[model samples]
Target: MKDLKDLTAIKLKAYTPVKSIRTSWNVPISDFARLTHNPIRAIVEGLKIVPNPDKQLIALSIGDPTTFGNLKPAPEVVEAVRRVIEDGSSNGYGPSNGFLEAREAVAEYVAHQGAVTPNDVILCSGCSCSLDLCISALAGAGQNILVPKPGFSIYRTLAEGFGVECRYYDLMPEQNWEVDLSQLETLIDGNTAALIITNPSNPCGSVFSKSHLKAIINIAEKHFLPIIADEIYEHFVFPGYEFHSVSSLSEKVPVLSCGGLTKRFLVPGWRMGWIIIHDRDNHFRDVRKGLANLSARILGANTMVQGALPDILRNTPTAFYDDLVSTLYRHAEIAYKSIKQIRGLRPIMPGGAMYMMIGIEIERYPEYETDLDFVQALIAEQSVFCLPGQCFEYPNYMRIVLTVPEEMITEACKRLTEFCEKHYKMDDRIILQQQNGLLARMNQY
Candidate 1:
């Protein structure tokens, strides 16, 4: 219809050109990328701390029970995974939520969480992912979630990653790290979306009793807010102390409990965790749908691990947990008694979990201004590494894992005592020494 010259001119005029690619990198990172800082990694890794060159380092910093080779999963737990791999049942893709059988197994195992069912279970990569799903599903930009002060840093990392605000409620160290109900209530306003309760807490190792748990649930019920119960350390309580799941204590409040095989089975690398919905009243009607949608993003957790759930949950003997708890209990006693003798450090006796929080009389250590400075000095002079409280958003305190071998803990405490004595202010050291002597004499009676 047109001449060749006219057609060529028309094509050239209509043609669109793409903007040229930039010569230099100027990509903008999303707010999630820029703001999602894990306080633990940031504080622990950011500090270029080097241990004493001359001494063998005794690290009480790691929370993993398997780090020192003193702990291992039961044989049946490993064999379950092996059987699943050999059977090839889990080789194919599973439902986005999880395999039905795995969900059922989890439901039955966590029956204590209050009448769970397969439909209510969503398998996740680990407790961390389970927590992420809960945080992202329940809270959104401009809303806030109440977290414990001196709490696990993962909550902040997950919340900020989703643009959710984290408001901390103080946990009283003097009251065995119990939640300050008054403070917790004050943190809640219309913008508050949920509350996170970490029982047998990671940094505190303080397990909530049934009554104490009920008190917390009452607050949630009163505020008409749901709860994100991080129960990864469930049932890890030492003897004489019982561990109660926050979900179990709730009747009116909906709870999304995050738990996993990572801690209990001592197979953290397996990355198997679950969320059990305990809505009872269907408060999570939309939340359940939201969780399912979020899970589709990852296509679900490892199928092999899912397949092993039934066997691992049913076959593992009770004695396995009993023995493990007994070992941890003994370790706790040893560390508590040893650290109690240190002049400037006051150790909080943990009731459960494998960690203890020690309060430092920073004023007594005149040379060090904060827990970080004190911890750095401890590592340099004594080759003993303890996590500074700044890692948990608490200052002038430190946390140590009780999962280390007994002899290592004993030796580590000895070193800690020596280091504290070296830097302790002269007058306070003498006064504390007298107090320690008086207490030791009183105990002798």
Candidate 2:
């Protein structure tokens, strides 16, 4: 044994570095770094350090409707949820697909747009969850999904986390944020699983025209890929613009319609959403099964919300929805008007939803080289916060959620203008050098 050991140990191999453990721990931080340290959060965090009660900050970073006094569901919807909780009927676990009545209500609600049936709908936690489940069910690692540039950040983040490549299709700003069909067509290939379209888009806030929806469907048909239609902001259109559901277009194409109670009903915290397979040609049977399986795996959405669906859908008066639309329209108008006065920013009038993208004239402001830098600077100087364009994949742009109090919008825009004006004269070499130094220092830690 000693002789064997001596012979084997004659020469030992040098220790090789084990391939770095390469944990996916940094994915969340890396994926959402901007959001994690979002200027809004920084402002709130900084406010926590101050002892003053008179000075409060205004937030324009999130699309929460509650800040605008859009609280409480319609009386009918409230009573519906109340009845369920009071009777304890919905306390127990319900069907994984959601209660039949809830599914039926969803089907009827969607049917007003076009032909959709109960078989087409699957209730989920929220629009975000619906997107996650749909993406998971359709594609996997190495597969590609086409998303709109300057679109919802969540889609890109979720798709990337799932190892799916997010190929961006440009939304033409000059064309009222319509999908650039040629650009979209070029991005699709055999490996592409789906194309996600956010109608009344998240950050851009432009609603798709009927022609635009048709063009998108044609592209999906040409590529033989399914369509994930995010219509969470479907009914939030302004007076002139109407939201056209992709399902209203060619039933030949498989449309996975994603929607929820959050935007229209103003109860985002409730987290009730649905994914309907609007496959008139029966092309999405496999995709539908996959979605159903995913839904089952996640159990089901909130039973109280699901139980409230029937009343929410059937009982809530059209007057309530009309009022909601009118309120949002007024707020959008106020925001658009106020932002126009800001020198370095230009906003596209949003047709629907609670957001608008303002183009940052970086050339006009020499102190800021990027949208993120500009936004952070504004937050620090004015105590007003907004999401940078890069968050939505739009460089040199920023998104302002217009759901804040109408009075605040005026002041927010005023501060923004002041900040831009103060920093506008950076042609001097000294100022430029100082800015670079400041940016470098900020990036260091």
Give the winner by TM-score: 1
Judged by whole-model lDDT over C-alpha atoms, candidate 1 comes out at 0.92
lDDT of each: 0.92, 0.80
Which digits, one per residue and each the tens of the lDDT, describe model 1 over residues 1-445? 4698898987887895656789998888998999898898889886657888998899899888889898999999999999999989899889989999999999999998788889999999999999999999999999999999989999999999778999999999999999999989999999999999999898999998889899999999998999999999887899789877887778899999999998779999999999999998888999999999999999999999999999999999999999988888898899899889888889999989889999999988899899999998898888999999999989999999988898999899889988987887757678799999999999999
lDDT of 2 at 49: 30
| Per-prediction TM-score to the true structure, in the order listed | 0.91, 0.83
lDDT of 2 by residue, 1-445 (tens): 9988876666332344446676676543454343223323443344323212343566788788876573456888778888988988788788888989899999998885577778778999988889888888888878999988888777766776667888989998888898888878888777999888889898888988888788888878877888888889998888788778888776678888899998778788899999888777778778877887888887899998888888888888999988777776887888788778777678899999888888888987887788877877776678777777777778898888877776787788777777877886545786889989999999999
Q: List the residue pairs that clash in candidate 2.
A: none
Clashing pairs in 1: none
Candidate 2: which stretches are off by over 4 Å? 1-55, 67-70, 426-445
Residue 87 accuracy (lDDT) in model 2? 84
Cα deviation at 350, candidate 2, in Å, is 0.6
